[model samples]
Target: MTKQNTFLNDLRNEAITGVAYKNLMLKKQILEYFANISDATITDLSKGLNASIPKINELVVALIEDGLVKDSGKTEVGIGRRPSLYGLKSNSIFFVGVEVKKSHVNIGLSDFKKNLIKSVKRIPFQLTNSQASLDDLCIIIDDFIKSLALAENIAGIGVNLTGRINYKTGYSYSFFHFNEEPLSVIIKDKIGIRTYIENDSRAMAYGEFCSGIVDKEKNILFVNLDYGIGLGIMINGELYYGKSGFAGEFGHIQIFNNEIICHCGKKGCLETEASGSALLEAFKIRLQQGASSIITKDRPDFNDIQLEDIIQAANNDDTLAIELIAEIGEKLGRGIAALINLFNPELVILGGSLSATGDYLFLPVKSAINKYSLSLVNNDTELKMSKLGENAGIIGACLLVRERLLELK
Candidate 1:
């Protein structure tokens, strides 16, 4: 090759390497700053990241070009020059989230900043024989994207399922039908967008982690108590999927000594005694036996009784309702105590529909933990309610897309 050509190629290679290194360093800084505060000024970001002013400026310009950050206009000051404030862009790109539960299906569209722009829910979307329902979910997602007028700008789609997921091959053993023929590939093909899937509980924990709730503490546990129980563990500030992606299947762990059958066909499982379904069953048995409870009197259809109803009944000081919730809470505490002993997490966050009962559930859980757990382990762990609320799954789904895109680039 000619010397001139070789020199030009070397220069190009150096430029490419320089850009890659700068982008990598800037990404680390941007993530750290975003985690520390929701937003920051370029000067503040430079100071926090310990980058030179020119380097920070170059990084900010590159991020803006990539549509990940935006200038929100200059901050007004009483003195000299106005400093520009840059923040993570909210809507330059979009992501789709599909939450699959036994009772319902929820689809949401969110921006880069994990803000829910639009959402839809379909209840009792049968999981047993539900191909049509799945197809409908695809249609709803397509419609939502079209509504946003950014169909081409969509980053990817993410689905959250309530079972063990194989992140490598995108297979789920718990939801076997969707395995091998992984939901990610299927949805990607059907919707003509990049797709990803994760276990629902893990996704919720990711949402909490990305939201700056669980910080560098690394080891944390998140328990979700809704129709059934779900658990998510984060180690080293990342989701810890054990061998076969079944690390956090806390619901099926046996809590009762008796041989009561669980949904997973296991006997004496935690879900059999402590989940919302378990509480509802207990309420029904009490009602049928002529036990006086406001739930039975107010809502005759036991099937119609929701966790919210139970919480409301408890709030109203319904004697039997309070007793039933407390019982479930106590059982849940026993199960959580076992987890605490085994995992010894720094934080344990209670989430899902049942968690909305707040202290009605927490008080009993605390009592049971005190009864069962060792004092040192119990003392170190902070048990708190999820701040993300019902939106955790959706936010996590969006983050999944962003995370994958970053990895790919």
Candidate 2:
């Protein structure tokens, strides 16, 4: 009754007595409000939540005692005295973000205010289709938690992974299929914290949305131009999950006529020609065809050239790199034009590694959208790059841990 018995005493006790159970639901609502709005006065909370002023004030006092809320400062009220403003305590609770890639993992910690407080990038680990790999992944997360050396107030963890994922059930139909338990449960069992799994692209898009940099648009299409193309859709400020949570496979859209097989076991997918891998492939093919690039050099050391090298070369004014990237952008834009016609989204955000090319990529995409989609539709969809860039996945994973744990995701 000294600590946690204050805010989240026991819901099971509600069956026999109504001491603390009922307040848990109300506290959750207030916590969610603070998570979104940052700070509020008691009077503002009363009016916004449509509750009595006394009740709101009591909860605010309780939250402060629980170390979750604090008096941020005072706000002017145009009268003699200023009103006190309450906000979330930045370090009261924490969320961890884990992004898994084929070659490495990205891990980070975020404070209650969604600011990334710590992170380790590109940790060397191979993601393979084996139980050892998944076990190693769990060990990696355990080690990260041990290294925190902070108070044990972690509320949740969010894992960002690729391929078909059921964010709702935490079951990944793709990787880690070797486990009988859902992927989230497996990680949670190891870390002893509630865990949530999400599609990597969707996590990135959500990061952009929560960053408050998308002009607060209600409708958005986030095109992830990573090693493989992906899409994340936000309709009416909510992440859209189709029947089975396989909603945003924008890369697999059949827009070309070729014999190339996609990772998803389909042919002529958009990603086969417009993703980071596609760009790399195009660069190599062009080099073999005698096209000039500073990175390619005399022998076209294909294995030596990385996607980053290509992007840097383009920024350095390498003609061949720019040409290949622009070509891929045009094709990608052609596919995106069809999306604009259908969704009529207010904004389209380009994210992931390949988006780093800046205008070398966006200009051609803009031109293609103008030419392909109807003027009314294309004009409505504004284009921009994600402010978070490569950090989006890690940031989004951390934010989503709070959101989904609070049932907001």
Per-candidate clashes come to 0, 0
Off by over 4 Å in 1: 1-88, 118-124, 176-180, 212-216, 303-308
Q: Compose the digit string of candidate 1's lDDT tens values, residues 23-58.
A: 664664674466347566778888887887888887
Instruction: Flag regions of model 2 displaced more than 4 Å.
Output: 1-19, 37-58, 72-85, 296-301, 407-409
lDDT of each: 0.76, 0.84
lDDT of 2 by residue, 54-158 (tens): 988888898899788899889966587888998888888788899998678889999878889999987888887788998888888889988997526777788
Return the TM-score for candidate 1, rounded to 2 decimals: 0.78
Pairs in clash, predicted candidate 1: none
| Model 2 accuracy (lDDT, Cα) | 0.84
Best by TM-score: 2
